[model samples]
Target: MTQERVAMIRERLQQALPVQHLDVEDESHLHVGHAGAKDGGGHFRVLVVSDAFDGLAPLKRHRLVYDAMGDAMRRDTIHALSIRALTPAEYERETA
Candidate 1:
């Protein structure tokens, strides 16, 4: 189920953005017993590198990610998302 959810998230982001690099990690286990966890939604962290975020501010970048996620958020497929949205240059600089 986790793998399927991750694939779904990756697919949605790829379809909505020009994704150069993407990684999705399931962290649902970290939130065991939490209120939101009771609903069976998973917690995830994503690192997305794309030219689409070139000049966008952090908030805008997050918004783009959220928009890409679409109904997964509302439908409880994704309860919490920790996003790291960046351009290729930013990703390189950070990794370096």
Candidate 2:
């Protein structure tokens, strides 16, 4: 997908999830010459901080984001996503 589409997706996710911090990085350059890039989709890294992730296991948090991405993954609009989800408390502790 185009960068605009990726940005839009990220924006929608941040709005819906109301995260304290969100970073969406496109890793398309790393995937250049790979088979998936032929379709214009690419890899991504998502870092998110939210109270909603409190009490959730790491796998559950990742699952929540994958579910939110929905058809984008299935259709190869997003080839791969690396997610780092943190609750507000966790984020503060890490930064401290």
Residue 44 displacement (Å), model 1: 0.1
The pairs that clash in candidate 1 are none
Model 1 misplaced stretches (Cα beyond 4 Å) = none
- Cα RMSD for candidates in order: 0.6, 1.7
How many residue pairs clash in each candidate at the backbone level?
0, 2
Work out the TM-score per prediction: 0.97, 0.86
lDDT of 2 by residue, 20-64 (tens): 988888888998989988876778888889887999999989887
| Candidate whose TM-score is highest | 1
Output the number of the lDDT-best candidate. Answer: 1
TM-score of 2: 0.86
Q: Residues 1-96, candidate 1: write the lDDT tens digits.
A: 999999999999999999999999999999999999899999999999999999999999999999999999998699999999999999999989
lDDT of each: 0.96, 0.82
